[model samples]
Target: MSVTIDITGLPQERIAFGPSPLAELGAALHALSEPGHHARLHGWTTTTAAGLKPELADRLHEADFMWRSTRSDILLPAQPRETLAEELDDLDRMDDERYVAAALEINCAGFYDRSGPSPLVDAAMRQRALDLAAARGPRQAAFVRRMLADPPGTRAWIRRLLEDCDEAFFADTWRRVHVQLATDARHKTELMRRKGLSGAVAAVSSALTLEEDAHGSRLVVDKLSDGRTTAQGSGVTFLPTAFGWPHLIALYAPGWQPVIQYPVSSGELAGVLPVETVKLRLEAVSHPLRMRLCRNLARASYTTSELADAYGITAPEVSRHLAVLKKAGLLSTRRRGRYVMHQLDVAAVARIGSDFLEAVLR
Candidate 1:
């Protein structure tokens, strides 16, 4: 029997960032916005600022010193809700052209160093400032208002504005925005944090371009820094023995590139399936008693005796099933007090399902 379910009727809400100069400015600032939430993002500002003109570099340094000495109290707070909310409201009320001009001016002033102002910075700043100020309200309200005023074509004005902001201001603004975002989405941030540190570490790793190995069956993972592992054998069927499959998938999805690298030793078998592994996975999946045990353990950890009583099976039968599943990499065991508790290996199960389907199709 086959089951088919169509999901075409689902409603989707698409988030569109419109073309206002100020809005573009805001969007550009997004990378720098959230501060305390992402420590890795700090590199963006420092790295970008290193290449600025000499005068601008001096100004950035001065601004950093000034900010450290004077505004430390305001900037060091755990949260800046009232300030951010006010800024956002102001940005919403501004006109695109005017807001863009104002933002540009702000950026230029922020970025200008002791060498004096450059025409590029001056022209760009004036344009953005006018774009932002054209709209009306408080600072943030005006920013948003201007950003939403026109179509995205005016984004050039905002980009120019960002380029002129001194490194100090750019970094500071980025941190502020990041903190606001983190405050708004505490739950998601916590979940990501618990998943493991691999994602966070990878985000900051040096970029490496991947290429197919000579064998045509594997991708070589290279461009590693320091003493980290650079390459490993990888495939849809190359199941992980630690942390199971879900964690592995999360770590190696398309969006999260440069993960585990494929080796050159594996020969190309483009359409071929690993029949033996598939058979093993299928047999693992078809064991009804094992499935029942997994479902029960998912709710709460259970001992063989407890599981046996719950499922109305003998203690020895439960033990046998647990042992088999454990050996199959579908379950994990830990001893608590005098009893051993069992839990489903969620990652392993997911990998088994994925590998089984892939093998059958191949």
Candidate 2:
């Protein structure tokens, strides 16, 4: 009935947590592109309707098999990779044999009921892309052909799909919302530090939840893959999701470290910014000078003098406004060599007036 991840054999020290850009990106892709998952993933449809051109929609609908109901193939985490480039780099590090094997594995109806290894694919490797291309569905076949001909290019295309959908669906919205997500992720990290490993894993979801059993730790997720998999010396990583709502995705390639992604707590993801924070954010744009400063930083990060020179204001005034926005968490600053650059939090303005999410749903 559920996939039991036996971590009893592994050390507690091996349990880890971090967010995966690939996992989140894959979930966003499915939520935005796949027709079969549209029911639970319903939120993305109206938001992406504008940017999803007719031709792209047709292609996505037809190529649904590549990102099928399970979506396990695309969720593989050979190692703990937090960025897109890092994940793809990890994929490339996989031997051709291992890569080919994991690429074809799927989660099936029988998988959940089995005591044995997954019944999705053979242990023996095959020419993965060619095999997928030979599938009965023309859409799947076409999609596989494209992947084979240009692997990097295909991944880039998929990335663009996620990015474009995020932009068009929300009207540059998710920025501020993401700050909440990041804040939640940080809180979870603090939980793990205080409560130990079990509490941390338990925090991810109640629906597709994680728990400890006599055998080891278990992750009960909403999917067909229902076989117990042992860490078998390879550890597991837990990642938090911000944009990836309503779905729990996992990576269980037979020979690799597993990664389970769960939705962050909604309580943390939503709710108004504190009244004071909201007031400060509003004030950040009220001044013609502050508004201009915020607008310039929106395009690119700037130093105090760089901003002052651009706006014909003095460095002192620029620094003062930047200080207020930074305190509001509406701007992020990072030190680069000798210069400290402030970047517009982008998530700043929508703290209140923009009901863009509500607009998308309508």
Candidate 3:
């Protein structure tokens, strides 16, 4: 049901927190390419996209798989890597075996074990990698073939693309965001000190929860795929980023310490959300009935008719509340058959506090 990290015997200090410049850079590139999805960063993404060189833009498209969905651990370090320069150097100097394994694991799911040791790239392992890549399609197959033929060359190409991205826009973006990230990490560290591990882990994201049973304590993370990995005494690292909003990344790959990169609680850009925007959000949920609707929708999506029936109100009345929420961008709706189902935008609603602060200060 969830990805969990066993923390029964894990010590407090072993659980660490920090900012990862490489991860932030990767997320920023991903945001630039997919601007529609990350509406929150529209202003920054637009500016960054205009400045990107044609060649760098083409390469980002060419190796789109690197940052899409589950980002390749090759691009994202599995620990708290401090500086972009240092991380890039380490990635450039990575050995062939590890490079191939990490890159192949991106497209070839289940090619390696998370709990087991990192497999050596023997002849059989190479064959399996190729076969899995072939099943994924020509593009993936070609990438894997190139990796197999020359690991160093392939890694170099990937590194250069990242370096180009840094030169183009990410360096400036990093300078602006690193302070916010460091501040957030410190805030979470304080939460850990005051509330212990569970409180801090819960604060990272709404999707993560700390639980315990006969088997021992584990930090459960909501993810599309389900798997469990133990701390193994190495503990886990938590990294906060401004670009990776509405999504949380957890890496439990073999041969590296587990790391979870979460979005900052506050809006990415300070003083970006206007006062009018904050006013609209507050007015959307100000009504008692609308507030109730939001609470219910947060738990689960419901149709207008379903909500009306549950509340003993008319469908038209429910529709009015849904309309207000939708107008303020507080809800998302989809048509399921004849009924329109409405769900609250949890991330957008959660940003009210931060947005309010920015608006007030501005």
Task: Give each model a TM-score.
Answer: 0.25, 0.54, 0.68
Native-vs-model 1 lDDT? Answer: 0.35
Off by over 4 Å in 2: 34-44, 54-63, 76-82, 107-136, 145-178, 207-225, 265-362
For model 3, residues 1-362, the per-residue Cα lDDT tens digits are 35777778788888888898888887786677556336688788888778777877777766665665345776666565667889888777777777667766654455334432222447766776665455344665687788788777878888887888788778887888899999989989999999998889878877788897898888888754456777876888888889876557777676666778888863443334679998998998778677666645653456676577556799999998899989999899987555566877756775676432222211
lDDT of 2: 0.53
Candidate 1 C-alpha lDDT tens digits along 1-362: 11111112211111010112222123223323222111234475456545556765443333231121111111111112333334344444544443333333322222211223322335554454343233211443344343445424334433333346624354454454444333423432343366522232232122222233353222222211111211222211111111111111111211111122111111111233367755665576577666556644432346676666556789999888887777776677887546576866544554455433222211
Worst 10 residues of 2 by lDDT: 353-362
Q: What would the TM-score be for candidate 3 when compared with the true structure?
A: 0.68
Report the error of model 1 at residue 13, Å.
25
- The candidate maximizing lDDT is 3
Show pairs that collide, candidate 3: none
- Per-residue error for 1 in candidate 2, Å, reads 1.1
Candidate 2 residues 72-105, lDDT tens each?
5555453445345666565555453343334334
